[model samples]
Target: MSKCIQGLSLGVLCLVLVSTISGALSHEGSVALSHEGVGRKQNVTYDGRSLIIDGRRELFFSGSIHYPRSTPDMWPDLIAKAKEGGINVISTYVFWNAHEPVEGKFNFKGRYNLVKFIKLIQKQGLYVILRIGPFIEAEWNHGGFPYWLREKPGIIFRTDNQPFKYYMKRYAKMIVNMMNKNELFAPQGGPIILTQIENEYNNVQQVFKERGADYVQWAGNMALKLNTGVPWIMCKQKDAPGAVINTCNGRNCGDTFTGPNSPNKPSLWTENWTAQYRVLGDPPSQRPAEDLAFAVARWFSKHGTLVNYYMYHGGTNFGRTTSSFVTTRYYDEAPLDEYGLVREPKWGHLRDLHRALKLSRKALLWGTHSNYSLGHQLEARVYQNSEKNVCSAFLANNNTREAATIYFQNVPYYLPPRSISILPDCKTVVFNTKKVNAQHNARTFHHVKDFSKGMRWKMFKDSIPNTEDTPVQNSLLLEHYNATKDTTDFLWYTTNIDVGSNDLPLLNSIKPILQVASWGHAVHGFVNDLYVGSSHGDHVQSPFSLNKPITLKPGKNKISLLSMTTGFPNSGGYMEHKIAGVSKVLIQGLMTGTQDLINNIWGHQVGLLGEKLEVYNPRSSKKVKWVDAKGHDHEPLIWYKQ
Candidate 1:
């Protein structure tokens, strides 16, 4: 049978088993199904060996799928595909910025609906791992923090600051309370089995010095107090507090990985990075299927009971949610691509590995483990269940370029370079990482339609008023964050400069240079409503100077500067004080000296006129009608309303 059919069959069998178990335990005071078909509460605990769910040891296989990254329409298919890929647990980071973009005002509808996403996963009979990092650094805007948090006075983020802690606790408690109200926690019979507090803090702890350790301890303590009734985890944290399980996160964590403070806790790999995220100008990254499979087999051989892929399916980073350096397309070369297509050997090979590992769960999880080093870079790991007389073994060759023939249990097996061989019975080779039995599916792209042929276009100019007709400020220039209040990326700074008759003689002969120093991602200038020039800034807060020579009329000439931001400052110390927009402006080659246009009554606009008209939303009733236009190409500043 095909894999899909097999998955369907397995799903039906699992449902039957769940029903039988629930009915059998109803009279024993154990968990039973409710009238509404919700699962009853069950105890989940972990020991030095593995996690025990209801007195039975389990091997967890999870996959990461951020809810806000994909649309609501894609949730069911994505969850089903993950299930088909042998994922029993679905992990997701609750993006704070997407839910509370304006601070205190939360949105849970459409793509930002966290509850709906969790329910979909539960419906598929999969568990959940909730990574609630209000300060998640998933290459997200402001590192998943609302922009308004910077406006608070004396605010320091991710530290021992009182203001920061108060808000963090508020948001964290809000999420926990919301979940508790709906009984969405594991203790309440929901699918959420594990919850993570802070993410990857140890990687940059030294940046905050002493306060860093204090912040981490406080955050962990705060999460414990939430009483989610599930095990709390902190990924990539070496000095994690007591009661919080410290998990490993990387491309490959070997057998030596153990919980930081609690070594006896179950060894859990929270993030096995399937592939690296895509940067703007960098080439795409991928891992070999053989190496990935070897990593999984080796982990199981070393007695790892829980492992979660960083991204089983990396979807698109829609709209402006992308960070400063990340690209629009977030295809991480995972088992499933952005469009939900299975990535050939990686998907099938891992599925096969999962099946093979499941067959040896009895011996691996509840047996004795011993490791022996064969010659060179080859090592042999064995797991034996003396009670059941079952045995499993993994022979790994870490050598990158040379294969090794190793003798395991008096039998010779050829191990390829950087690969592993799995022996389910300890005497016979059941599967080899280098030998791929799955088909190599390839994808082909074809252009199906010419969309421009049937499209009609319309043109409209931005109706920007004069500087005297709008709000004015006497400062050099207002910061972009302060003026826009994080409402939109575009901010307009309009000012007027009057040239006397005496200056016209010199201005008419020699073009005056319009210089504006801005601290922003990009800036576009306009003189008398005509396009002047544009320039961009770097990632750091450096001043980008826009120097272009221009003609000035004898009367008042309006100068408009539009500043745009790729994303807000996400990290570093005192980042809340970082500012954007025009810092200084001067017109060189005037009559007497350089005229400073900084301190003036500058008109301000928050966003583009097209945004005000809801041009991007096709379903908006306020959308304007489009008329056919004959302009093949035009200059900048021309807006199309189609």
Candidate 2:
């Protein structure tokens, strides 16, 4: 061959080579293979009888771990830990706001390198379950939807509304197209066998009413049209419509609660809330490790072929992403803490439990389950294969603080309080939730430096203080706008008011309320330079409310309300249009029955001057003076004593 032809042919051959390896199936089966690069989609089939991986029967175990929750440097270690815990697949939701913070712009570098993440999983000999929720409600801010979508006029989320559908389809296509280029689907020989759409829609189904169901069906249709050759799933969606497999998402998911409308589909647990979330002002909510093991063993004994722990490792919320409804600290008490440290007994105990479950893979993946009551909240379930050659058992005590010993086939098995024991061999008890055999490693947290002794401080005039002449948007009535990919929790509202001594007492009489309907990541109020109040709402779905009646005296009073958001609302009905800035503020009894300030021309600013200067960490600022503020945005903003 000529040198030119040889080079051209060589280039084509290299392209083909990458495509072939990138899209290789796990098992030899009928799943079609795509000649695209890794991350492409291929048709996949699950015939109720078997997963039919590449046309062959296979058993799979998966776990959930969000990428952004942990640093990219920690991915390999986390994945290794998961594999050690008997996981054959890694699952994650592609956070929308994290990827496309601004409209039409995309950032997949560094920690957001999703393609790299998937490739890393494949390297670890595991499959991937990509949940492209564009609308993931992972207790995250705004449920993972982009803030920019809210900017669109008349846009309703998770509905049959045209605007929502258009945006949803657009995002879906973007993902599919990106993956297609890489051939990430099973047919393409990549590890991705399953993909999901619209996370836990069923959790909020009642809120959608008729429009919700229609929206779900529409989402399903759009997913199918993508034809990625993988089984599409809808987690916690009861009304998922035809061909859309509805999967369970919770601490315990069993086959007993199969969807009435989709009986033909297989039962899968997409999220197993292994450990609960802990918040400040509340007692820790740690499930005894034994209970988690028991739950898994129960699922296996009850013919559950697939069970995914909601958070195999709940990593840190980090940066400004720490969401809260009230002023409470949230700790998941998971296998891993925010700092990437192992969560002692919980982690080790569950690791052992995974081993016990894996030992009974044969009986679990293909067996008939039968349950029998052993009395006293004690229950026994047996899984026997078609040939009766494989047998596994589970003994559970449902009581929160009781132990039970049950006889199975004349054999006695001891189960601890609120625990379950798994016997893969039907002879030896391997895993139990309540009984802990692992070492407990305690955690300690200390402030970097104690401010009790006090430190030197300085004060400077805030360039962007609540002042007159600031620009404000005029809205006669309440209006909510989307983030439009602007991820900052900050929105500025400035308005001038003429007040006097008589007006002040009148305002105090009627309770001059700062009724801001702000769906902020957090909210702060300022009357001129004096700080009013600040509040951080619930992390999952928190909005600020400055309901305190402020005493505003006479002479030009400048009211500045700052609404800060961690990220944009990503899920829920019309969440895209949820009000983020100061929605309503009333200075009642100013003079008449109600002198509502809703009609005042309000100046709007997107973010803080410090943020604009990229001054996230004050320690690194040599030129800037740091001062300890008595209270954050306190009324008559007090400077901390130097």
Candidate 3:
């Protein structure tokens, strides 16, 4: 290895190691890695230690990068950066909604092109790990489920329901066949080596009892039937079938994870959460680089031969792909930030750590390992070949507050608190968990104004409910998710409130409060076409209400409420069953104490007229009468563009 692999944390194009496909070491129950897949066909088999490609065990450093989160032009740079960062394998989840937004309609163009993304990785002498979780809960909309899937007449999600299974199996087979047709699997001489079926089902399986467990078994079997000629895996799932490999997922799985359920499988850490995802209205969740290095070392020391960073680079969510409270900025504080820039000391520190792991390749795969302690709370893991010579060594200090000097092989070694020191030759300290040799490279974006294009504004007011559109009228208010199937965000709820002459006499002194109780993400209230108030919702109290003072005519007054949704629920077992829209409409502080308008004839308009006409774009702005918003600035329901 040269200076290029030393401190260069995700440098653009200096991956000297890309030219070779050499054997690297696996942990205790050993295996070793070979070259990337291409040209000639190869077999992928796994022993009790790690994945075997071309009859060799692989010590993998996998990086996650979802293709749909980025554009085609951005793939080469992102993949190259991952390769430069010492990642031999690329991991990604197949988002169902992005590919099949409408029933019988599929899209694989532009950003949703999975085939192009995988090929780009193969072109760089790297392997691919396709996690085809049609129900992936990546904080993605509807948890990567197709919009039409939730609309099926008799359907229950993630259970032993025939309707759900029918669709899930259909989609999974479709993906596998697509990969097979493209010859992407390793057995077909392509880059893909491993494929994953169900994502973290164990977390929510208890909610459904026996049905969830049955579904888990069925899912594993269904994936095995695909026969991609590679092994299948299920993460966060316990009691997995014999054909599937059960892997660990968490920030630290070294101490808690007890390998795979079966003896024939290896210890694999699928998701090493680099850092938690940043949520809306909150600061970026962070995990220190040193601590991350410590965790990786611990996992390897504990016999985990394969490990993957949940997000080596968490790209942009873009558009309305975000779910729950997760921000559109999907930067997970990872090695590569949202913009694909190397995240300073973090990227550099991990790169050096990978280099050290690669250097210990042969010893870790074939040598006998002996575990011993240097002192109290200090331990050493040493691997030796047939000659009994120490080839790979690791010194770890488990203390969080106290530093220690441990003597290994009769030589003194200093370790920082909560750190790991790697000595590949048992004498030279190549890398330390606490050391950061990479320089910090912060990204700066410049917003320059084009003075030539003068500021001219195009404005339009959004249409109110029931003016020109048809609505679904019912005696009871309908759940927005069920009513619209998430076809639109703006759901118009219109109803009439009648106040008799006798009730006005007592209402002369007290003004009635218009309280619109909502179950939606947001609600905008209007009394007789006049905008009153609006209340937004978070992951917190979702049944939020909007109480505003109202002056209504004594007769029939139409109340129009616009219920909006940012995105649907992404987690939980029965998350698809959540209801959205107005639940109750009440007129309080009246002479009669309170009047219930809940059972009245309520009309629902699925979407807005402006949205239907595409008036937001310059080409379609001419279709509608755009109001000059020169004076009415900062007002609600007004669309403005420059």
Candidate 4:
């Protein structure tokens, strides 16, 4: 009862658990192997049971490594590390926004070079799973859709709408053609064995309502037409069409998930999340290495043939590519850290589990399965090759608090609470999820510099234009993206307000305040070029108001507002419609409607004037020279350069 309640329902969990045990032990299959040489045409197919590579059943271990996440120089080392970690396949999402930031224009060089990354994987004797999601939501900008797509009139994205489908088809075809021309498809004897059409669309498909199904079907059909000669998969899309295979994407998926559509399709876990992506102001999320290893072992025990870690090496986000509110460090606490360092115990422990799984491959892939209830929350699952009397087994203890002992096949074995022990012969334990054999290494930070010697520094002030000098727009406010095209993080909103004697008397009486309402990641206010106050919004889309006191100048007074963005919203419904910058401004306590600056002709500047002068560029020919400085330490509004 306790086991059943802990699993939320004993019958369902037991039924699935029993089925997994039976599937692993009962395999009435043995297929002849076909050989192939390097650079030779190979075949990859899957029956309802398992993946057949060159006419023989095979198991695959894959890991995700986004090319754009890491520099080009890091690719070879990263791939090599993955290979050494017992990974036989490398998966990557071809980022649409990174490759084509502008419509009708594409870039495939440097870090965005998909071909180069694939080739490197192939050189390491690994297969590839190409996820070409024009709508990939890997916490990417605009969900990997180019921002220019928002400019298209009446263009509803990720749907069956004519405009969206047309553009989606064009881009998909472009990628397919490029790969085909380079002979990079599996049918062309390349490393790519599988291609993913769409990402986890089912999660947000409800927003599209009736069009969701149509869009999914369309995406599947489009991928099939590409003729890649490899299977197409749709992760997290349960109602996926017949042509595409739907796979699971989270941890412990093997415990509850089976192939969608048909049992004939092999069970595949596309993304076994090792750790979670970090957001700003949130603690780093981590998964125990022991738990991760247990998940993998249980997956294989349930007859899962292919399992891919979402991130085997979660690299750095670098630059402004991170999603809004996400921290600059893209560390997902994967097997490898952001700097390519192996995450101890997790890396070594998983390596050992992989080795143990390989030892039982023959029995697992071709034997008969049986499961027995050892009672006391302990279970024994066995896989036996009747002809050769060869057997493998998994003994599990599900109780959360107390460990249990079980006698399987008349052999007494101690089982740790909430753990699994693997026995290749069904009688001796070779590996146990609870017993860790890897070394643990703690990280420490060392101080590399002394600040006791007060160092010399130089300062430069940003040369910003006043309302009289900058270009003025008739509109009172404008969206930051539309005005700046995301070329810079800063947007200047400057306007002049006249303070007559009548307004001065009111301003002096109530201590008049300048009020501004805006949508932003952050905003700064200036009155007569004097810094007043600043405000910030949440990581997601949010509206904030700023209020600052101002001194009346009697005649004309200038107000400058600086609106800045951390990054744009990368996911959500109608995110393209989100706006930034000051929407309205007013001086309260100044005699009502007379002080409204809503319709004023505001001066607009895309970035600081110092940016134009190349003051930040160390190698610029027009770069400003630093001079010996004194006094003015810790002064605000001063820009320091090395």
Candidate whose lDDT is highest: 3
Runs in model 4 lying further than 4 Å from the true structure: 1-38, 256-258, 387-389, 447-454, 501-510, 589-596, 613-616, 625-639
Which wins on lDDT, candidate 1 or candidate 2?
Answer: 1
Q: TM-score of each candidate? A: 0.87, 0.80, 0.91, 0.89
Provide backbone clash counts, one per model.
0, 59, 2, 7
Q: Write the per-residue lDDT of candidate 4 for residues 376-471, one digit (tens) a residue.
A: 677766676766556778888877778776655434678777888987766567789888898987666687865435666676776546776777
**How many pairs of residues collide in model 2?**
59
| All-Cα superposition RMSD per candidate | 8.4, 12.9, 7.0, 5.1
Candidate 3's TM-score: 0.91
> Which segments of model 2 are wrong by more than 4 Å?
1-44, 54-59, 259-264, 278-284, 320-331, 386-388, 399-402, 446-461, 464-468, 473-487, 499-525, 532-554, 565-571, 583-601, 617-642
lDDT (0-100) at residue 161 of candidate 2? 87
Q: State the C-alpha lDDT per candidate.
A: 0.77, 0.65, 0.80, 0.76
How would you encode candidate 3's per-residue C-alpha lDDT over 1-642 as one tens digit per residue? 211211112222221111111232222222212343244577999988678888776689999998988878989998889888888889999988889899889999999999989888888778888999878899898899877887787899999999999999999999999998999998898888889988899899999999998999899998898869999999988778877999999989998786799988988889999888876677777888898899998888777778899899899988778886678778658999988888978888888888888777666666667676666677777665745343667888898999888766545688899888987665578888988787877677786987335666767888676623445787888888888786777788888878776665364656778898888888998988888889877877678889988777778888889998888889888766877888999888766568888888888888887888887677987778876667776777888766
lDDT of 2 by residue, 250-300 (tens): 666653456324546776778778766554345666766666766766665
Say which prediction, candidate 1 or candidate 4, comes out ahead on TM-score. Answer: 4
